[model samples]
Target: MSSTDSSQLQQQQQQLAEWKLQRLIKSLEEVRGGGTSVITLIVSCKDQLTRTSAKIAEELSVASNIKSRQRLKLYKKTPPNGLIILCGEVGDDTTSRGKERKLLVDFEPFKPVQRSFYVCNSAFHLDPLRELLTSHERYGFVVTEGNGCLIAEVQGNVKKTLFRLTASLPNKHRRGGQSALRFDRLRAESRLALVKKVAEAAGEVFLQKDATVSVKGLVVAGCGDLKNELKARLDPKLQNVIIKMVDTAYGGEAGLDQACDLAADALAGVRLVEERRAIGSLLEAATREDGAIRHAVFGTQEVTAALRLGACGRVIVWEGTELEAVTRRHAETGEEKVDIVAPRVAPVVQTERDGGGNGGGGGWEELQRVPLIEWLDREVAAKGGELTLVSDRTPEGLQLVRGLGGLGALLRFGVQAEVLESFEESKEDGGDGGQERETRGGEEGDDGDDFF
Candidate 1:
């Protein structure tokens, strides 16, 4: 294929991988912790095929022994080369008391790990899985002159020293003029050889593991011209992976850590940066409009209304906000009941009796509460809009909560001009009072009640 075609193919593959990863993350997020009764197990099958079954059987035996009441069923299937198995099970509360439901998750596209292990717990913990996914980026680090090492971060786990090498140069001033010139040439050749060796080692690891897609990039570090020499000598494939070069105090494994630490911001994943950018865009658009009735809406009530009308194209919510909605039910006898709810809110009993007397029937049951954020997530997805849960970690994210009232949305189109004019008129006449009224108007529904 032509060079351009090859580059395009690689880009397509990368986009596909990113989409798959996003889907996997969403799937993992959907798996709520099942309290303490759930059993989560992950075992690496990187050994000989004969030992793989035996290893899994041994681990399963231990898990079964610990959770004797819960019968663990192993899904018997042909093990692929370099395959790891992650499975979980919890008592099926919806069914009979003794029954259990197993969660057999598919973690494809991720290579099997090098070790074997199992875990039993009350909840299906996903930290290990997340680490496995995030650490797929293979980065080669080389500090020229003395020390160099290759490091790979997969799913967050850092594998230091995939390969290490050291080289010493000859002293140039050890002899007279002609001897000194010969020594200088020899030193240059030796440094070039060292660079070639480092590049070759990186190629070997990346090629052996088929890490072309997973490799994020490479970093070269040194004080003098050695780093540039290494870069110049790197194989074409290795050269493509080299991201940046820096001067560092250490070489070898320590240099690897230092490079990663210094370049942490640059190495922050693309998804995180994109998320921040999207939030910033919403903020900018809102600020430019400078009114409540514009292409962007802020505060919980306005955003909720925009969502209800299918006018919102994106929903931005502050992480960890306790948003809620009330669900009310009425009977044929004209008796009414109200219950405050949020997404995933557990059911509760009401103590008030129906008849308010000794012989009265039991109080009406309150509907199951769902968390407001969870409800918003479903709503945004249903409307084919994006939902971003921004945290207080960054300044812009913090402003989304503290400055913009914790919730906002970008609309498909601007609101009516008349509404904007009315808001402006109110602001002019009442000053602070008018602004307060406008805010209250936005907070209240058409019926003058607080919007849910």
Candidate 2:
């Protein structure tokens, strides 16, 4: 294949992988392990398969290891890039009446793993894989106060401070009768010097020779408003992408780490901000258009119909979408067609076809069913369109799922739902399809009424 063709193919593969991983993360989030029974084993290309096998055998005494070991043996050889296996007893662990459950999920990633690791915790250690899904773009981190300032960069799993400075701001001369006005004037001059020092150092660390910011985004964090004063003197390009201004209880290295924790939500939402903007654009076109030449549509039926007719421009789907793609065939005409059906009804359709067939009185036979997430990716790419996955972390993401049925698209030309939909769009359960109970998360009681 030509270079352009190869690049396009790679891009499509990445999109499909991203959708699959997003669904995997959602599924893993729902799993609740009983105490420290969950086992997470990540095997990279560099790890020895024999040693990995030995470790699994030794872990047989653990709650879920027997099954995990058996599953591990199925792979005679290690995957080229690597594989992750997360297994444990996952269910309601708080009460005696709660039922017991066992879950083992193993898959090879689309990219190579740098190292191998193992852990047993109440919940699976998902940080390793999450890093793979996160943007590799670096971001600037600035932490400063009356004492000092530290400038750093964070990219994926690493954080490094490239510049450090110590400032000895003036303090009142309490021993002698030093003039109050003199002390105050000296303090202001020191503050001005600190600002200029920070500006020069920031340029050296965060700017390129071409005069543009080196990082994709920037986050300023420290104890007081000193960081704000410093921000004003930084390059205009760097200021534009500032993700947050975090407040910490200390300055220097300790405060830099603290700032990371405080500003984590902002950092995570950097990618979501772009996705939300796209949703807003699609929503705008959807509301303004009229008649059959409509520009926007929500729900599975409208989006699928548009894609089938080569009219889809942009497609956005929820990370936890419930629809499954099913292939159905006409019994009378011997014709085949594809449809998105709810999981509950898909089995019934398959059983009906197995017994014989039924449609137009005889019935349409269900031939095959693939994952909706993967199917949607392939469908959109086939038509030269892009698809994005959104989580319910933000208000717009939640609104899209609750009001728009979790799947929507912008269309080049409109398509009628009646000509496409075989059955009514499936209603999602009260905004909790794959509800996760995070150990550190405190928003379990939230009903999300504020977003509306």
Model 2: per-residue Cα lDDT at residue 81: 85
Over the stretch 1-452, how does candidate 2's per-residue lDDT look in tens digits? Answer: 79866765675476567667766776566456776788888999777777887887666688344277777778887899888888877653342535546667788988888899888887878888887786668888888888878898876434677999998887646543567777788888998899889888888888889888788878888766677888898878778989899888888777876776677677663444445566778888878746545677777656765665677877888867766676666466565556566553523322233322343445656566666777778778889887777666555677898999888888866655454342222211111111111012122232111110
Please list all clashing residue pairs in model 2, or write none if there are none. Answer: 358-362, 358-363, 358-364, 359-362, 359-363
Show where candidate 1 strays beyond 4 Å: 1-38, 43-116, 120-269, 290-292, 322-328, 331-365, 417-452
True lDDT of residue 23, candidate 1: 44
Residue 220, candidate 2: how far off, in angstroms?
Answer: 10
Task: Tell me each candidate's TM-score.
Answer: 0.44, 0.52
Model 2 error, position 13 (Å): 4.1
TM-score of 2: 0.52
Top model by TM-score, which number? 2
Residue-level lDDT for 129 in candidate 2: 83
The superposed Cα distance between candidate 2 and the true structure at residue 192, in angstroms, equals 7.9
Q: Give the range of the ten consecutive residues with the poorest summed lDDT in model 1.
A: 433-442
